[model samples]
Target: MTAQAARHHAEGRLAEAVTAYTDALRLDRRNPALLSGFGLVLRDLGQIDGAATCFEAAFALDPGCVDAADSLGTLRAGQGRFAEAEACHRAALVHCADRAPFWNNLANALSRQGRAAAALAAWRRAVLLDPALPEALSNLGGGLCDAERLDEAERTHRRALRLMPDEPQANNNFGHALQARLRHAEAARWFRRALALDPGYAAALCNLGLAVQRLGDGTLAERLYGRALRATPDLPLARFNRGLLRLERGDLAEGWAGYGWRFASGQAGGTRPPRLPAWRGEDLAGKRLLVWGEQGVGDTILFSSLCGEAIARARSVVIETDRRLVPLFARSFPAALVRPHGPGAAAVPDCDLHTPIGSLARVFRRDLSAFPGPAGGWLVPDPARVALWRERVATLGPGLRVGIGWRSALVTESRRAAYSRLDQWGALFAVPGVVFVTLQHGACEAERVAAEDLFGVAIHRWDDLDLTDDFDGTAALMANLDLVIAPATAVGELAAALGVPVWRFGGRDWTQLGTAVRPWFPAQRLFQPQGGEDTPGVLRRMAGQLDSRLI
Candidate 1:
């Protein structure tokens, strides 16, 4: 209330203003104006505790003070005392129910309590009271995002930006909503705007990192994530993004350890639902470990290679794999127990160590040279299935039986995106004295029709020989083939595990193991893209390799 204190506060000299206000408050302890002025100066100076004390004293002197109550509630929210903040907001609302800022504060307090529906309703009321409440609209968008209503969330955020074009929080929130909708390009644009507004905005930087990662720029993503970490070290999203980048670059040892932070982050790319607890650097020696399968059946088949190595160290190993694979894997690993997949009467016993099938490779994996070629075939053919497959192969023809598969696995986004073009198989079928047999499963109707059109009688499509639908049947048929040529897939792995001669056709930038001949499977050879539109050329080369070796 003093002229000197007011002048200092107006000049943005908050520390000086606080000292002058404190002296004036000391002179007249009962003056509400002096106490409230001191509290505002203290709050600006970041002395939250002192500010709260001053606000409470001012409110005691004048019981109907709105600013004092609002400041006190904000301090409580900062301290993470949501219940106390809610009480303060509600009391302030009783005095001034129609105030837009008070309603926004109340909604924020409700949101902190995890009452998202009530928070949304309060935010709607706040916006109705003041249409220009950009912060309120942004908060509403956040609530909608929490509810997983991404489209509406995007619209709300855009509306906020339209009202306050340069609002930092609005830009950040809009970017986040766009990213949620998988609009990576647009999200990157909004995130850049947010960064331009405030260069050290940690959340915006982290979101930009994720968007760029989706755009397939891992190096830039890593740099952005690192910058976010420097700005806010405790941001779990940035930490998890850094971990994923490391994992993608094949730094599995540190990657798995950094990946443990996903549990702490409530991000979308965090760990999927697991049937068993994830292995957390727990000592597995002398402990019964249940390695439960997650994701698709082929992933289970690919990961099963690690079971033998893991079982060597553990007291006992119990594998809970896909039901279709039980007959095959059980025969291969007689030492370890096998349980069929899905719900059963069997109680999941409390095991000292449990790991998802995917994580096993990280712990007990070897380099390409050291890969222990699974003896014989882990996926054994059933007698009846073999009989059925033999009948189908005989019906196809008398030419050199060349098994051809083009599609990759179709479980996760990564797998679905890794398919080999069908034209890649055309040149191999065009080769002399070779018959193209369709070995792929989950081929689209369009792909199947196209295969028939391209290869004619040389291409055989048997509905009964689906690798995904019946693994045992496919294994039996693969066992009878002269040569198996396919994309770097689970079936390719399975064929090699069977010790059958296979030529793997790879994408231009495929797995490193697929680029070179795998020593683990001496029976296998790799034919990668020589560069551009040359899948046909890769296939022609593989046909030559097969003609020289097998013919």
Candidate 2:
């Protein structure tokens, strides 16, 4: 009977195996091996409760049943009960301490529980027990990468590849390590290798699409995303990437629809409020609406423009935003109550419907024509602060006062390559009657000194204001400037929102939909490097434009 049950299980007939195993268990109810085999069959048949009972009985009958303990641990881990899984794995390891599979499973559970150091130790033990375990080596490589030991991770991944050259997971993980190091071209090759091993691998396809996108092939990346979605229809990462690609191409309708998947994809921060229903373009004649901010400060400022439209429909509105922007948002939207996000803000005020600030685009700005004009500036800076800044600016001797921001707060390699270098501002500095004031926040003393020494010009700095933490003060300072010349940072966004003239420098094909200007901010001018020209060339062109304007 046991042989027949084993045959059924081996043949992949889970239901037949369960029936035969039950008959065999009835004959020898107290046999630990029989009970463990029955538990395995039950687990395969999807009877989780029955399988757990059989495993527990088998363990009670004979605590030495290592297979029963290992199986139970795997089941618990799959069910997200990592602590119970760890206990089961530890029991199995007590009997077979040298077992590679037992140590590997223990490592997986520990890693899922966010115990990275312990997980690394367990993984190392597994590899030491069996040096040929490719999966363990791959996981150890991933752990090393997470610890920022990039060189060791690369070597470990190479070892795994040598052992199992055609392993899809190892290939994909190796590609990820390479991608983290910004070797996109090499990463794409490994991703392709993974796809070759298993063509239906949705994760590899999505990763390859990102690699190609970074390599400046948006069209191909879009096609890969489409393939990934077709293979795995509910993949959030693929959907989110598709949405970004569509938006970049100016397909607003499809773009906004895909953009709504950001929260589900975990690309956007914060979970949706549990009790409040999401707003879906319904008429809110007498209901209170909550509009909460998501993403960065620049994104919040950009999306705040839609509040006026929301105000026109809802009877009352409440805005929850970053702490720094509370004063500015409250004064700008006096009709609505404004609060900073924190502990008490989690329990939202009485509201009929709630929506993320970015989600408002789907309801209001469905197309390019739906955007408001240059007169649509909704942010109102404090008049007193504006007056104070105006008086301070009067002491700088009457030239064209320009606020310059050349760096972003979150500096990445891609941003560094895209933004204008401090030395590149030589041409702009040489422009007569143009006085440059530093609007950039953070540790700029080194860069400022270098720029001044290199360009032989003084870039004025104000020591009294905390530009990064004080949005209202920043807005007031922006209000007093004649023009702002900056990269596509938050400063540019703030200046454009305040109706100040801004020249935003960017990389090739960065301006959305190939347009020379962004429809969201009509007061801002978009400048891209022309004819293989670098940052210096772009700055020279901007200087020439300023010269013509001054003349």
Candidate 3:
């Protein structure tokens, strides 16, 4: 009967195998191998609790039972108990050190626990044990992509596809490697192939949507995202992608809800958010609120617009922000205690409630009506420093002081298409009676030199003011500028927040929230690309405006 049950299990007859195993187990209840065999059949039949019980019984009878340990570990992983899964896999490996699949399973559990480097090492060990292992190769490819070793990932994924030709997950993972390399069209083809293999594959659907979105079909992208969510309603990547699309398309109510999935999608960075009692727009009449900054420096500034509103409701407010912005925030919100924040900022004591700065938007800026603010700006610069900067700029001769930033310092391949060369802005640089000054915060000396050498036009910047570290000084300097022209970078955000007339170009970000004008900044003059218009082309149009209006 045991032999017949093993044969049935091997032949994929799970129902018959279960019945045979039951009969065999009645005679030999303490047999570890029989119990493990029954567990495998129960697992195949989707009776997870029954399988776990059988496996636990088998392992208890014989701790060296490899099959029982491995099966239980896999089941734990399926249940999202990754740490316990890791321990089980480790125990199996101790007795069966040569098993490649055991290493692969262990790698998966490590990866889920956010130990990327350790997972990659484990996957490498699995591949070393059995080079033909398709799953390990596929997972290794993903790890390489995460580490930004694109060339290695591309090669690894191609090999994985060769081994797993009809596997949807392998194909989808390969497409991710291609997508990371900026090969969107090719990635879309692989994603389509994955969908062909498994039409209801939610991951492939979401990946295809992203690839098509990059190809400039927002409508198709949105439809694909919807389809993916319909297949798996809790798909994080789909929800996050759909949220960005909805925000850009002007659908706020659903957009913010979807955007909240960013933390799960790994787009917002960090493995864990600050551990504290989350503030959900509660009445804080006598409560202290601790709001920590997330995202970039510019984002902190943009969201700081709501600090005053938060302070009005709370008895006391604690604004934890980038160290550079500490002085500026302290001066602006004198009523609040502003502190310099780093990692593990949630340990602040005496706070009644906590919230990430970005979450403030869902409550305050639920509609377009919440965007408009004060005349001067939400952030107030030091009066003495502003007057000093005004005097310094007055020495440069009589003309409008215009601050310009051509591009972001941290431009990756995905962002390269949106940015233009600094020389492409010669038309704006040539605008008569405007003193072009560099508002770029980092590594602009090289670009400024090259631009001056190429066009005989200099974009002047003061040496004393460290734009990167001295936010107070940068704020004061920006307050003196007549207008600021830049891409959608931190410079543009700062200038706009300071209430200077800022022309922000090359923007297709979700932060626009579907407004022609920046509802966040009353002084912003948008120069976003019109249909088929590149940023350089948009800058040329701004040049024309510069001559016609400002000049």
Say which candidate scores most in lDDT.
3
Q: On residues 355-409, what C-alpha lDDT tens digit does candidate 2 reach at each position?
A: 9999898889777788776673679999999999988888888789999999886
Model 1 quality (TM-score): 0.61
lDDT of 3 by residue, 1-551 (tens): 98999999999988899899999889999999999999999999899999999998998899889879988999999998999899989999988999999999999999988899999999999999999999999999998898778899999999999998999999999999999888999999999999999999999999999999888899999999999999999999999999888888888878888888877887885334556688988788999999888778888899999999999999999989888889889998999999978665556576888888888888788888777654767788999999999898888886778888877777765667656788798888788888888888788788889998987886788899998889899889999889998877888888888888888888667887887666788667788778888777898899999998763
lDDT of 1 at 427: 54
Q: 1 or 2, which is superior by lDDT?
A: 2
Pairs in steric clash, model 3: none
| Per-candidate clash tally | 0, 0, 0
Reference-based TM-score, model 3: 0.85
> lDDT order of candidates, best first?
3, 2, 1
Q: lDDT by residue for model 1 over 1-551, one digit each (tens)?
A: 48899889989998789789878878888887778778888888888888899888877778688778877998899887988888888877888889999889989999877688999999989999998899999998988887777778878888899998887778999988877777889999999999999999999999999899888898899899989999999888788777767766655565555554554565322123334565654677888888777655655676787788778888898887777777777877777888775556125664656776767755764334455554554455667767877887787767788777777645332343345677556555666777666777764557767767877744666665565767777778887788887776777877776666777776533124332544445556767666454666666787677667546
**Which has the better TM-score: candidate 1, or candidate 2?**
2
Instruction: Pick out the ten consecutive residues of candidate 3 with the lowest summed lDDT.
Output: 267-276
Ten contiguous residues with the weakest lDDT in model 1: 508-517
Q: TM-scores across all candidates?
A: 0.61, 0.83, 0.85
Report lDDT (CA) for all predictions: 0.74, 0.86, 0.87
Instruction: Tell me the RMSD of model 1 versus the true structure.
Output: 8.7
